[model samples]
Target chain A: MELLNRAISGTMESSDIMVEIIPWDKDLEINLKSDVKEQYGKQIIALVKAILDENGVKKACINLKDKGALDFVISARVKTALYRAARRSQ
Target chain B: MFDNFSKKYIYSQNTRGRKTTSDFLKTLGLSFDENVNITINILDGKRIIATASAEKNLIKCIGVDENYRSKGLMNTLISEIISHQYDNNIYDLSIITKIENEKVIQSLGFETICETENIILMENNKNKFKKYLENISKNKVANEQSSAIVMNLNPITKGHMYLIEKASKESEQVYIFIVSEDKSKVPFETRVKLAKESTKFLKNVKIIEGGDYIISSKTFPTYFSKNVDEWINNYCNLDLKLFGKYIAKELNIRKRYVGKEPYCELTSFYNKKMKEILPLYNIQVTEIERLEKNQKAISASLVRKLAEEGNISQIKELVPEATYKYYISKED
Candidate 1:
């Protein structure tokens, strides 16, 4: 399903990632603002890209404001944001 | 002790290497806003001792190392930001800080405008904003039924013209504030010129600059943020609240005119928020249906697309004569 509107999930608090998804014309632009960018940035991006590819989100802008969130937290936040963007709970 | 301290502008790519600036912001419990345009960092031989950032007209995230506090580094940082803003033709500067740091900012000639329990909003040029309002009020011939429209006429189309004309006819005086942020494909100078020429026939309309207070990157950074939903609600609330509480009162504006947003979700959300919030301040929100052609809404984005494709014939139908002429001249 196409992303209908802009949506966000999670918060800026510790151990969580605030994921925001917005519609885009072409390509997926992933911007990550993380506290641990030097150590875990690449891993986080890979996880998010895998999730987007799985969900068939081809053209969208995804922004992750991460505060030391683990892979599981990142996955949950991205899933929630995508669901919210598509206007579906699941 | 301060001999090694050197001030420099922080570019986006260089931010990672500037650990001192990042550490300073982190210590103050402030996240480094990636949208920061002008940043002044005082480094003591690669150690960031003091730092301040100005997004547009609002200065924020100012922090100094505890070791350098009593030596007046904060004052220097604030002064530098002020000078930077002034150099950019931004006269109305504001800073939002915790109540504890209020006195420090106040010492640098900023006066408190509004205060909540946790934060205080101070401005360096409250008098300038007030004076601007007074000038508008004094010059307005029909102040009895005044209205306002804050718009970014990126490339003024017939839709913008329609809204402005409607507002001009309905109110005794209409203040058309062109958004001054230069983040558009069409430069601010060109947009302002096109808007002025397009609405020259409307006698009751007075065109002015929005002046960093309305829909600015400082208050509403959604325009730049790819994640439009993240901070839009909070920023829009703060922006509209500032308008309702201060700007509306100062200019005696009782009504605001906006175009109906049917395409962009962010704009639609902004309109909804305006309708819900403006009434409390007694400023009525009037959202006019957008002009359409061929069953499609006429928008600046459409005009831009047509221009990019070199479709002048179709572009002529969507834009006003002034915009058409401007585009034609640019083609030459």
Candidate 2:
């Protein structure tokens, strides 16, 4: 799926992740700002990357501002952000 | 001791579970507004030990737990907030601190520009702004009869070009300050490029970067935030005041030009505020009616929507020739 426009999902609340996806022409670029970066940063990035790969998203810029969200919350936020970027509800 | 301390950005909606955050700020005789663009809280095992809030250009309501005083927690929290602002491309930051906490913030690279008995207003990059003014003065072709127009030009459309063209015709010289904040989907570089390319024919138009001074994330974060009418009013007032006090005087701008916005409520409100505020600084405000196409307003947002829908032909109609060419080149 290709991003059609700039779409933002989620909130900055604790246990939540705010994800913003913008259309990019090059490779997938992810920038993460997390409170729990010292602990589970790598795992969170891997989860987001896996979700994007599963959706077949090739060129997009993803910005996530995390407030100690769990893996499931991170995955759900990424999926919703991508869906919104692609202008699809699912 | 520092290992247990972690700083995190807190959302305003989470206030329900974080009563202590407000209570902590209140204990220090500071009030927190709901319009804060970013709030960083230093936590010690789930207890808020220190907090800092930034609204547009002003950083205020800094409170540290009494027990954590002089432990370098305030400095650390402020550093984090400053770093966050810089990442968002806001280099110039201002803070209004109480007389007691003035030295602490001053030590963190904020110079006291104005001081009252109760509060001190300090800002970073004070010398940089002065240098910017000096540079503009040196290259300024505009005399006292000059007018200024500050625009985002998210993707310079015919509407923006029309406004610039009108301003140039009316004033001896028009200073076109492109909003430097990178809040738009169109990057600042591309926006500036399109504005310059589209307006290259206007010899009386002086294109300059607005830098972090005008309509910046520091001064107008409400423009990017969710629809909060009150926040928009508050931040817009602050930004316009800064323009009236500093920008207008330095550039000798006698008039400010703006497009009449009939669509966005926030922009209309800002225009109304400009009408109210600029007069106090002896500057007149002129609003030109927006250009139209097919009986509708020609706006950059509309052009962006067309581009998003991949309606390149429709975008070509809304934007200037230079902008259309640039987008077409990008597609290749």
Candidate 3:
């Protein structure tokens, strides 16, 4: 219930993050070897912008390896990964 | 409106202005008389990105669901919201949250102080919160003479002159403090000199340097970062503790004069705190509504930006000829 109990205070650093999402639903699977179109990257980036914009992260470079997870799952994974990455940077 | 650290990115992202559909869902809602109105959208297109709202002063709420996570949507939305509030004079803003939400908020320059069980009161500065309401009640009516005017004259300009003139007419003495800092384009001393010269006809006014304690941008960078409320409580609380006695002694000033900052959230908090604290010192707080030209509050920043673009003509209209010439010649 308590998603954040620790101090989120510290300096921010940059690095490449390859996020892998595993969906609870099996139907979400897609081509793993398909070349990701530039547009898809842009779409994912838009989603990321929404998250960061809502959250207020200015200095960060995130890399994602999507496994076609559901919306809630993707959000949790990204938030967890971002928190982890942020902790590592600190 | 980005009254937190993430405001910088919003400023950067604003330049790109991408396109998409879900972006329409980024409706920042405002409720008035129980009517809900959707404000600006944060996305470029179809994606429902992050969203933020500041109808609530102490805390502006921002929400970004999962699909929008990781791309800085929340940051952008919050930044934009904060920027909007700052532009509208809503300083001394804050965001309410539980302990777990610390990282996301702190990185954006929010300072956390314990407010209640499990609720961390993250604010920017505290000194600015000492509202002088008690003093106002005690004083009953505002005295026309001996009012104290405080300002962050980042650069004193003609519009500022108009404010000083207005105060001089109403008060017997106006104590003006020019903010001093190394990053200032025009040194504090020079600003004080210019301000003094421009208001030379007013014998009752006096100008002094705002001590490092009050004006250091390092102490409170929210003005530029758009994170004024993030640290305003801490700044105000600390300052009130530090300057409480000093302020009581120096001017014996019963009324503190401040210019209306329509765009900064912290200023509103300041007005609130001044009203709260002045009663302790038996002082009162007065706000001078801005004298505007072209519907814009004449400000030092506008002057500096205009001067940078060689737009001294308009600058002259807001400032005295001597001050206008000073800025123009400095450009040369």
Q: In terms of DockQ, which candidate is strongest?
A: 3
Candidate 2 vs candidate 3, TM-score winner? 2
> Which portions of model 3 miss their true places by more than 4 Å?
A1-90, B1-145, B216-230
Which digits, one per residue and each the tens of the lDDT, describe model 2 over residues B105-170? 765556776554455557864676677667667657747778999888888998988899989888
Residue-wise lDDT of candidate 1 within B55-142, one digit each (tens)? Answer: 7787866778778777767756765676566546564578876578887776555688766454567885456666756654554554
lDDT of each candidate versus the true structure: 0.77, 0.76, 0.51
Taking the tens digit of each residue's C-alpha lDDT, what string does model 3 give over B20-115?
211322332211111111233454343335545444344433455556567655444544554455445453456655467787666444566434
Candidate 1 Cα deviation (angstroms), residue B17: 5.8
10 residues in a row with least lDDT, candidate 1 chain B: B217-226
By lDDT, the best candidate is 1
Ranking by lDDT: 1, 2, 3
Recovered native contacts, candidate 3: 0.00
Model 2: colliding residue pairs: B56-B218, B57-B218
RMSD of 1: 22.0
